[model samples]
Each structure stands twice: as C-alpha cells, then as structure tokens.
Target chain A: MAARHTRNIVDRPIWKSKGEASTVSFSAFAFLFSELIQYSQTKVKSTAELENRLEVAGGEIGRRLLELLTYREKAPKRKTRLLDLLKFVHTTVWPYMFGKTADSLEQANAADDEYMISDVNLALTKYISVPRDMGSFNPGALAAGIVKGILDAAGFPARVSTHYVDVPGLSKPQTTILMKFEPSVMQREARLEPRAT
Target chain B: MALIYSLYIINKSGGLIFHKDFAPISRVDLNDSLRLASIWHSLNAISVQLSPVPSCTGIELLEAETFNLHSFQSVTGTKFVLVVDPRASSVPAFLQRVYQLYTDYVLKNPFYEVEMPIRCELFDAHIEAAVQKYPMMS
Candidate 1:
C-alpha cells in the first residue's frame, strides 16, 4: 500500500496548475450564506451588530482569497498603489468570487481618501430578503468586509460600509460599497505617486 | 404507485430531529416515533459492531412482510429513515431529494438550532411538494 501510494504521488502531483479557476456552485454558497446570516441573527440584538458579524466573517474569506488569487496569477505582483489595489479588487477579486466584475469603481468627489464600488444587483443579495423589522439591514456588509479585508491585507487600511441607493429606472436598489482610507494610508499613497508614475 | 408511509431524520447522536407521517391517517404517535428512533439508532450501532467488514454502515435496507425500511446515512452521521410499502420504487432517490431539502430549509433557517426538532414552515411546504411528485398507492 505504501509503495503504491508513493508511485501514485510521483506520477501525479496533487495540486492543479495555475489559472484553473476553482469554483463552487452558486446554490451551495447561497445555502451556506443563508445559514451564516441566520446564525448571526441569534447573537446580535441590532441590525448593525448583525452586519458587523457578517463583515467579520467575510473579512476572513477576503484575506485568504487575496493570498490564493495572487498566487494563482501567471505573474504574481503585490499591489502597492491605491489605484492598482482598487482595480485589482474591482476587476480580479469581484469576478473571481461572484463570477462577474463589479459594476463600477468611482472616486468620491468630495474626498480624496474616499472611493465607491457599486453593483446594480449584488449577487449575494439576489436571494436574501431582509426582514421588515430589521429595517435597512444589508447583507452586502459581507462584501464590504471582503473589500476591507483585501485592502487591509494589501497595506491600504480603510473603512468600508455597504449602502443601498435607489436608482430611478431600476426596480431594485443598487448596492454601493463606500471606502474611506486612513490618513496615514493617503499620506503613503501621495509619497508613492511620483515613483508610481 | 409507491406508498411512502413516513419520513424521519435522526441527528448524529441518535435523537429524532424531524418526523412526518404521510399516510391518510397517522399510524405512529409522537412518543412511539421517539421510541422507534432511539431503537433504530441502537440497532444501527449494533449492526456495525457485528459486521465482519471493516467499515460496515449499520442497516441500509430492511425488508419485512408488511413494509420496507430504507436508510441513508450522510457523511455527517445524520441518518434519513423512510418507511414505505414493500413495492416502493426509487426509495433512495426520494431520500436524496428529502436530504437536499433538509440542508436548504432546516439547516439554512436562522432560527433553527442543530440537533433540535425541525419546525420550519418552508421545509414542511417543500417536503409536501416533493412528496406529491411521487404518485401515491391510491
């Protein structure tokens, strides 16, 4: 048995080559997420607390996913600039997890440190119907957590929150993830801008 | 036509988490169902010990003069037991669909605690719909 096991390992390595795109079924994720929200509901008294719990859970996934995805890239390069990092999350991370790129990435006009990532219809919220009593509860908090986790891990510590904005023509409200970078992070980005150019 | 008399879900620790009778008139009382669950749990364990094979799962199927008992044990050690008429077909398939419903409704429900009795309205509704798909003996 031991000899055969050794022979098998030599012939076929366990790990798959890069860019294979490991994926889980949407229904499977939906089921697991539903359970997560339900379990979180039992522990929190307020919707804010529930969102915080979900964000924390999502943060863990984001941190790990960042590491895994970078390793999977053909040319793995650590994102150092703020724009590069945000674009990575927008183009790479969102599609990797949700099967589609985020709808838009926009800089907040009022503040240099603030930015927004919006989705017309968030995949996570597609099946979730927030209870009436839990007014304005957003499961998108998990996605915000993911963004925060990725940014923090990538050395761009920021505050991220999920919001629902009503669009005039759309039946469903769009989800916008707002991010506010720390003062220190903005200072670092300013210093690196000359070299980045 | 298949006659599925009842369905029961037993948790890993051998406690009855859910039970439903589909016959026109209920045959087993709550107490009787509880007793039967524990009895089956013990019997399953005993069968495993008695088996000469290394990894014998307790009882998969048991045929009697009147009814047939079909059991499917998931990887988590939870057992889904179905009691139906002797001529029942595709018992395993029916149980598989029932297990999927358990995961979706009972497990996914936020208010539900693991190993506790299932009382989810959505679960009950879906189970009824799934059972209806199978033509009854009538």
Candidate 2:
C-alpha cells in the first residue's frame, strides 16, 4: 500500500510543502488583485457587498496564513494571551505579509478590549484607487478581515475596522485598524490571569 | 528541442491577469488577448465536464503540428498556460517554477493589487532569463 501511494505524485498536504519566505513581482500581484476587485464588483449588488466579498476572500487567506506562519515559526508553544497574540501579529505576521513591520500598536484606554494596529502604508491598498462617490469603499476592508480572521483563530473573537490617518511628513496616508474583542474574550482573560499568579 | 513562446495566466473569473511573450511572436491586440483568455477559461471548464471520470482534472496539454500548449491550475482556480515548441518535455517543471515565482514575488509584493495586469519587473526579469536559458530558445 505504501509503495502504491508513493508511486503516485501530488498527494501531499499543503503544510507538508516547503515554508521558505520568498517574494514575487509587485505588478503580478497588482494585476491579480485588480481582477479580484473587478470580479467582486460584477457579482455584488452594492459597495458594501463588494467589500464583504473582498473581506471574505481575505479572511480565507488569513486563516490559512495563520496556520502557515505558526507552523513556520516552529515555536515550542502557541500564544494564548491577548497581548502576546496581538504582538505576534504586529511584529511577525505583519512583516511576513507586508514585507515590513507595522508602524504602531496602541491600547485604547477607554475600553478594556480595544486595540489598534497602524501601518504607515498599508500594503494591500498601497496602489488601489477608490472612486470619489464610493466614500465608504476602502480596499483595507480586506486587511481588516484578515486581522479578524487571525484573531478569531487565536480564540479572541474581534471586530476590525480600518481608517486612514495622514501624518505630516509621510507621502502616503497611514492606515489604522481598530480591533474590538468580544466581551467574553476579556472575561476569559480576567479569569485566566489569576490562576497563573 | 523545445522553446517557449508565450505565457498567459487566467483568473478564476475568466480574466487575464498576466501575459508575456518569451520569444517574439506576433503581438496580440489587448482586446483579442482578453477574448482568448476567456475562451480558454470556458474551454477548461467544459473539458472537465466532458471528462469520463468525475474526478478528472481539467485539460493539461494540447498538441499541434508546430507548437504545444501546457496548463496547470492552482487550488484557487488560477490557470497558468504556456505555449511551447511541441517537443517540450519539461513543461510541468517550468510551470512549477513560474508558479513559485508568482507566489514569491507577485503574491508577496506589498504594492500588488490582486487581479490587475501584472507589471512587476522582478517577475519579468526572472521569467525572461529562464525562458532564454531553455535549450532551443538560448
């Protein structure tokens, strides 16, 4: 049976494939993404629908990337704390996806479960142009979904929103992603901290 | 000996995202290339349906008198099609290398907008060198 299986190729799991960090052409990616947006435009009824489609597509990629990155790191244990997971995403995951580290991470003082990750030039939307009429349309919606997907996989259910912020000296607009964890996640964190101490 | 002539990548939605000519062939008009891409996409789907086996993968190769067409589809339905001299035997290997380049340079590039016309210089340079190095093309 082993011989028979070995005789046939192309039957391995995706994770079993190599995990080396590599880079591809920017124009190729731009072309492919342009098609994704155009395709979504045709299938959806409204701008919200298009953004949702892009989000869904991004979430799918994020779910797989979460697994791929974790496996690549070969860390002895998985991250559990909310802060640790967020840090991992900001430092490690962001660079892996965008070729650079995120600009900043901030904890919102007003809310217990609120956090923010900012990128001076969000990679996904670097070259995207939104029509003036579609004021709410932001390509970063896909990035937001990716963040939500990663957080959800880490057991911290969260909602993520993207906003643009212009810094005085920067050529490109900065992007901030606001992440709000569900109440249960905060409650779980509160419950878990006592036991370790 | 086999020589590569051109390559085209069609997205799942029947859109042409990448098109490159390795050796100079007659230039295809932009609109015609789009039409050809959609036709290939439809034919790929139709070929799968016509397969006797339900598990049959779509068309992999088409041979003609002077040239041959080789194709590979990613899990996400992005199709890579290559036109090469009919004698080519390493088409799969070439396709895999191009796919690797796509994942590395194109997918990983921060400035890349998915599904748009590919304009990455590195990808072009790498593929150009690869094509030129082929036994016949060189």
Q: Best DockQ goes to which candidate? A: 1
The lDDT of each candidate is: 0.86, 0.80
What value of lDDT does candidate 2 attain over all alpha carbons?
0.80
Q: What lDDT tens digits, residue by residue, belong to model 2 across residues A39-141?
A: 7887988888887887788788778878877887656357789998898888878888888889899998899889999987676765564655666677787
Clashes of 2: 24
Candidate with maximal TM-score: 1
The regions of model 2 sitting more than 4 angstroms off are A1-20, A194-197, B1-138
Clashes of each: 0, 24
Chain A TM-score values, per prediction: 0.88, 0.84
Colliding pairs, model 1 = none
Q: What is the lDDT for B97 in model 2?
A: 88
List chain B TM-scores, each candidate.
0.94, 0.92
Quote each prediction's TM-score. 0.57, 0.53
Residue range B22-99, candidate 2, lDDT tens digits: 766677888998999999999999999999888777989999998899999998898999998877769999999889
